[model samples]
Target: RANRDHAAGCVTPVISQNSLISSIAQNVLSINPFQQMINEIIKQKIAPLETRMQQLEEMVQDLQERNDCLNYKTNDLAQYQRRCAFHIYGIAENKEGNKNAIIKYIGKVMGVKVEDSDIYASHRLKQNKQGDDC
Candidate 1:
């Protein structure tokens, strides 16, 4: 009778341990589907934002290219304007409209022959407080 009781006691503990293991496995199985569903939901929510971010990056790149092109065009235009114009400073302001004399003076100083027709326009700038034309 004692041996029978001892065998029953051992079998009860084994059955309890198996029940605990089975319960834990069922919990893990249920949680796996729930976790998978959560992951799918997160991915769905992030997809549109990711696409919009990529589009914005492309737009910024296009704008930068356009800005660079505009800067190059501006520099070219400035150079073209400069080619047709020249500024001379430190010449005494003559009120007699001495455009020809100025041209001769410049030609003599630069060792270059300059005729009156070579200058398209000549005008004195406004004198500053120090009596210098700017």
Candidate 2:
């Protein structure tokens, strides 16, 4: 009789476990459709934002390329201007001398007739204590 009672007790626990598993499975099945609907709604809301992000990334890339091109052109223009520039050394530093005086001196000493209109601008640079032009 004791052995029979022990066997019945074990069977009771097995039945309770089986019912618990069945209940959990039913709850999951009921929630599956609701979860799927929520996921779909989230995806729908994010789709436009994802597309706009892609477009913004493309715009940023295009702007960077344009900036690089402009920088290259600016450097090229600087080099071209430097090529046309001329520096006259060994000339006396006259604090009172202006652009016209320099042009006249060039015409008299170098015998090169430089027109006033031909010269855009001229100025004496200051020398540092180390004798370097600043």
Candidate 3:
């Protein structure tokens, strides 16, 4: 048949099943080590990077919580400071308004007999949010 085809100038394509199977097997065998090497690289380098990123995220969260606590403490300290301070309304703004004299006057009016040493500090208030001129 091959001779007849050659004599008739007809080309016959040849395909070997064994050759195709061997080529596929060789490709499959070659890919295994490369895939294993890629897996090892991910485990060695990328895995540690992922762990470090998680640790950094945890540290940032801890710092944020610490900052919130500090802010709360600062607010508490401000409130405590204001606790020692007193505000007296309806006191007009005068250039010669002495704080000590005003304290004494208030003490006498309330019959408390407050002395200069007993008082810490005093100041006239401005117009309040309710439009009360103090």
Best by lDDT: 1
Model 2: pairs clashing at backbone N, Cα or C within 3 Å: none
Return the TM-score for each candidate structure: 0.69, 0.67, 0.69
Of models 2 and 3, which has the larger lDDT? Answer: 2
Among residues 3 or more apart in sequence or in different chains, the pairs in candidate 3 whose N, CA or C atoms overlap within 3 Å are none
Tell me how far the alpha carbon of residue 80 in candidate 1 is from the true structure, in angstroms, after superposition. 2.0
Could you tell which candidate, 1 or 3, scores higher by lDDT? 1
1 or 2, which is superior by TM-score? Answer: 1
The C-alpha RMSD of each candidate to the native structure, in angstroms, is 5.0, 4.1, 4.5
Question: In terms of TM-score, how similar is model 3 to the real structure?
Answer: 0.69
**Model 2 lDDT tens row, 1-134:** 99999999999999999999999999999899989999999999999999999999999999999999999999999998787567666678776768677766777788887777877667665556797654
lDDT of 3 by residue, 1-134 (tens): 98897855533232355667889999999999999999998889988899999999999999999999999999999998888677776677788778888888988999989888887777665676889654
Cα lDDT tens digits for candidate 1, 1-134: 99999999999999999999999999999999999999999999999999999999999999999999999999999998779677777777767768777877888899998888877777666658896655
Question: Candidate 2: where are CA atoms >4 Å away?
Answer: 1-22, 95-98, 104-113
Ranking under TM-score, best-scoring first? 3, 1, 2
Instruction: Report, for every candidate in turn, its global Cα lDDT versus the true structure.
Output: 0.87, 0.85, 0.83
Candidate No. with top TM-score: 3
Question: Which stretches of candidate 3 lie above 4 Å from their native place?
Answer: 1-15, 92-94, 111-120, 128-134
